[model samples]
Target: MTFNIAFSEVTVTIGNVSVDGYTEDIVVPITVSNPNESVGGFQFDVITMPTIINISDVSSVNENDFSADFNIFDDGTARVVFYSNTGEGIPAGSDEVVLNLHYNGMDVLSALVDLEGFNLTVSDADGDVIAGNIVDGSVTIGNVVFFSSDIPDTGDVLEQVSVDISIQNSGLVGGVQFDMYDTPNYLDVINLTTTTRTEGFQIDFNELDNGATRVLLYSPDNQNIASGSGPIANMEMVVHDNAYNSNVGVNFENITITDDIGGSYWVAGVDSGTVTVTPGYIEEPHNLQAQDGMDAQVLLSWDPPYGPIPSDFSEDFEEGVLPEDWITTTNSAQGWFITQDGSSAFWTVPSHTWYMCSNDDMADDDGSVDYLITPGLNVSGAQNITLNFASYYDGAYGQTAHVLVSTDGVNFTEVVTLEPSPEWVMETVDLSEFAGLPNLHVVFHSNDNGAWASGWAVDDVFITFAAREIDRLVHYELTELGQWALTAPKDEVMSRFGGGLPHNLKVDLSQPFLTENRPVELDAFKVYRSLNSSTGFQEIAEVGANTTSYLDEDVVNSTTYYYYVTAIYPDGSESGPTGTVSATPVEW
Candidate 1:
């Protein structure tokens, strides 16, 4: 019996694997080194924990003259027996594959495969015992749960910032622990709180190495609880007073969770978050200084304007008297003047008055040209300049208003021509191409070419520098994909289409607001509608941030509806409403 074998090796090809929900299959191979003798048969008992893996199939690799038969017993063990089928036995002094085993994952855990040396036997062609050493292999099949969430991007200095942790999946678990680390230059974690707790699980944490590193842990003392997906913890930090960067890095490192059973598992992935430190709001008083004459050589000085102005600026003409900052041409007779409560001889609505009007006294100056220019605006540091204004014009078609712009009041360029409308209409003009000019001017020059029916009445003028481009999100009833690429919202003001329900209309919605910036994500959009343009604007719907549109099936036929959108932020703040659009429902 000179059967001296080199080694017996059992190897599982892959390392740790994550099981999604159900069981998965794995293949294991066993090989052996032979001695200077022919081999005839071999027998081994495969053992594994019943809660980890179950032997499903066992078979020989089918050598030239060998066959195998295996029987899985109730005791979580398998007996595999191999013998020479044909007369010729396997040659010696070579490494050969002895068997291929198939295993089924049982629970969410790691399983080991071992060959019991006491019950294992090897024989030659003469049915005599042979010698060999045994080796084992293992496979880990389980889920490594973790949290994936976002935090607000922009935060004021000293503002409270909090981040949450959540589990990705469900399993019987003991506890979870992780170390949070980051450069303390932006913010300091002042407190750690548990949002969720397992039954009988105790929570503990300690500062590590430096104050910037924190270790958090939670586990049950005597028993385990079924753990599932939800918030597990929250870390609150205060923004540093001196933090003045565009972005700060915050990360959760070395996150791990333990099973209620035997071993612990690490998170499969992690999504890091960032915090942006923005300057605090500095209020500067609004001073109505006397406007300089429209002489280009005057070089009007913008005396100590208020602190950092918003990207978008607006004036609704609510102030009965025109601001002195607005410059007027020498010919004041034909220039613009603010009128309130039917004060002007021209048109005025009780519900919506307070507008600047070109003198409707046609007898005073027929065919007269009047120019009303805005205060010198600082657009040198902005992008996407836009001008929006509401106007009422019922004069002859040729008797119109021309919107003009100038960097120097001396040289002006025409941007748009407005036609006469019996009712008030809101209009937007793109001034993006002319941005970055320091001394920018928006001028409304009116030409009374024909019969002055009601002259030009303007209100709600918004001259926005670096006009924040509306980031659009649209929702549809039937879309091919759930989420689509980002796009700028459609800028259609007061558009009427045919579609609405008998009671409420299922209106498709699209908005131009962003929801990505953390901490201040766009939460929702408040929808407003009016029966007529001049009156009755009421909130009709509230849609989520991720949703693009809403179906307003609450309406009646033959009734016209005007719609507007206001973006709501996380801090209960709201952006100005979008220009109103109209929709009317009709019976088929």
Candidate 2:
């Protein structure tokens, strides 16, 4: 279609920044360019915000919706210019859009109607300002780089010093190096064995002085992992994008020495005791072994791995006292159980097939499998879906639990959504639809988004067909549209949505089905004491959701009273039937 069109309008809008708040007046710029044919009047909407990098550019714009894709003309043209963000922070984020065809038709033209809201959140976490509670935001310090992850203290592998870091840049490079300082002094290897670790993880950080080195995994040998050794200990690297600042300064903490395993270590000069903190403990190499005796040729009784536990993480430990949470599954010399080696491991049998991916293999593919799972997961699930798998899902990278299920031993459909991570909540899906599934073979999977390098885990497959609420009926009638939403005084419904192991309840089977003694599984239960439904309630019982099933222990002899129940989910989430389980207690 040969035609011409142009856009001419100036308008931008931003909703009030409340939650977490925004501090910019990002605007959308409209430009109508008519080629091929002549068409007047520009009209369009700011449908969605694209990757925004500069907030200042947006703040000065006339349009409210900043980083978004907007087309001014219908007459298609191969040549076009548009605005986009690049570094640290810019256009925040939002599933919603902002700034519709707020411009007049005379200046802008658009076929796309209806726009949504836009949200933005950005900044540096370590610098002056840090981006926290990040959802979909990203850091884009273009052509600029700094130390990424902190330098790891090799503790006792006392060899060289350097850490790997995830760097983001487009610039001139400089020499990367390190140095030791103070009492816990170490040597700076002059002739370094600078080798890159994994495929994507190249931690050849050149240690210049004692300042921060652009390394991800730290080591004492002043080099990356050597050929075919265990996995390389690395971290994200901070590179100098510009020659002006090629050498970033390191600090005392950056002075790490790769300690040799089987040696004593010091913490704040205090004796950490004769502990062996090796990079790994593989089984194939008589010198290395996994905690669970995974690849061990001999029986290795499992012991408690130091540091971290669900309780230890969520506990109140005093000075000098250790926490009690790590549980041992097996103490026998014959049974399969994970052991507490230098690092966490996965293996039950002595199959001699146990290895963890190190910073190398753990990366995309450069095969250095010295990996480990810290406080590794151990949960259960059922069907085409997984139940409760534990994982520190890299919040930065959208990750899904990779799961494998098979009706027969040969075929497998990768289940995309595994159990939710780092939470006690349960995510359940129906597998009754599987061709042969809800049937036989099933295995949990973890889809590593390739960011954290930390693998996903599964402990158990709880194939316990969800014992649903017995005889519970969730009819459309039972499901209220906005029952949970704040409603008019009498608009709320009473539901058993929060049905849990209730400690107390009073079920008066007498005048059932009334305002009183209405055992609702919502906010609360309003129990009434009346001889009949004809009279109003006497507010005899006031039980909260925590009060699941109540016991009508106190009742007048030969008296008839009704009861109600209500439940409240922890989120102050309310549900109901308005007349949950109403019963009249008769001396039956």
Candidate 3:
């Protein structure tokens, strides 16, 4: 006997999914609805764009009711077959997922998942074809938000640094907002600005009471940013002076992006970065020792270490005229000239009272080009060459400035472009590429491109470099106790200490021995003392870098105190502590 059953039409659908471009092994489900009879078997081919995504596998959602198998083709097709092994059927239900299609993303794009490529078939328990409606779906790849810093590992304290917040493989975006957080003791946010990619957008930021900086960027005209990879905003910050020998992290939270029509975008992932603060290029004192003296005094001695040397070509523009050998070439009447006046209404004052000025506001013509050239420099044996200067520019009418270098003073190569700064700011340009050139010349060029713009002013120009060793040294005569210990005559030392009677303690000192001949200019020396050998050290006194010894009268008799010394650079960076030495003082 056979029982006849009436089966309603079934609707089959491929579910849509959104994932990140870096995602792998994504699962999309195929669902069934409005089926009156039990479903026995089904077969279909899932197809997609070959370059956007590829099918990996297909699995049955209801494993006990059905078994599934799939074959992936090279043309971005997956043939899926599902059937019941025990001759039983899956009881039809409302919106039931039968099979899942797994895929891997090949690129950042959108692709249609179509089911019309192959013959889609469905059968009932009586081996009869079931009429059904098939629906297609889609897959969308999303964007990745991350952070990057120019200072990858380490930066000096009080140095200005920048961190970039970027989006990768992005879609068309209309607006973005996020909150950034960092240790307040480590870094201080100065300002937020737009990059070249988002220069047309308006940007603003607010510092919350909870130490979070909230930033927002959007176009007033509802314009969208096309798909690309770049920094949307740049964060300018200054490292705190107390952040030395520490790692500081910058993080993002509550990130959101919107399309032109106010739809939310899917974010794939987010990443953060950190910077370490370190004492740069300074050396610590060496061979520190202490000895007991009569009348309960502790005598300390150490060798001073080297520090960063001063530049040879430093000009403050205080002579009221251009130095000899300096040249100026201009197409305008008002070219480069020295001035101490700051009464101009168009341009700001220079860093110092006297500075070089290229006044476009005082020019007669519309377009002006001016060049200030330096004298021939001899940097044949220098390393880490750099050019630093203080500048004030008013770019109200689109004036431009640049720093260039040349070997013949005729053919110049651009080293860096200067940005508009209404106030006085320091600019640094790396010149290591032209380090070995014997006759290198530097040029400061300014242009007002057919516009009545303000002017540019510069002061305190310096061209610094490092060499193998110091060429000259300043001699010190016997003045202080520290100098007398290192430079006193033999007879003078005997007259002070040779007698057996009670006398002041004498600590002999020597100059620092250099393993490698890299000589830096010294600033000062710091002395630290502790009761223990390894910890609890406090700064006792500071002396000149040339001074080699110190007399500590603030000590207890017959008590041992450990001491160490460190060198301080001109930039306020301190070296690591030297080896510890012990001393005991007593009354004779």
Q: What TM-score, over all chains together, does every model reach?
A: 0.40, 0.18, 0.34
Reference-based lDDT, each prediction: 0.55, 0.26, 0.67
Q: Tens digits of per-residue lDDT for model 1 on 1-588?
A: 375443333221212233433355666766766657666777777676333566777667775667877887887677877789875666776576767777775454532333343366766667666664455554445555655546545678789877765666556666666776655356777776666454445566677765545545555364554566655666677886645434667777776667766566545557766766665222211111111111111110001111132436677667688876787663434566676422232222212336677754333455345777888888888777877666655343245678999887767899888754333445668888888888898988877654442356677677766443221121122122111100111111112212211111121124322224322245676667677865789887776754434445666655656565665655465655544444445555
- Residue 467, candidate 1: Cα error in Å is 4.4
Question: Candidate 3's residue-wise lDDT over 462-493, tens digit each?
Answer: 78885323222211122255334323443454
Report the lDDT tens digits of candidate 2 across residue range 337-363: 222111221101111112111221123
The full ranking of all candidates by lDDT, starting with the best, is 3, 1, 2
Off by over 4 Å in 2: 1-398, 408-410, 418-424, 435-439, 449-452, 466-588
User: In model 3, which regions exceed 4 Å deviation?
Assistant: 1-84, 87-98, 101-154, 280-588
Rank order by TM-score, top first? 1, 3, 2
Question: Candidate 1, residue 213: CA error in Å?
Answer: 20
Top model number, lDDT: 3
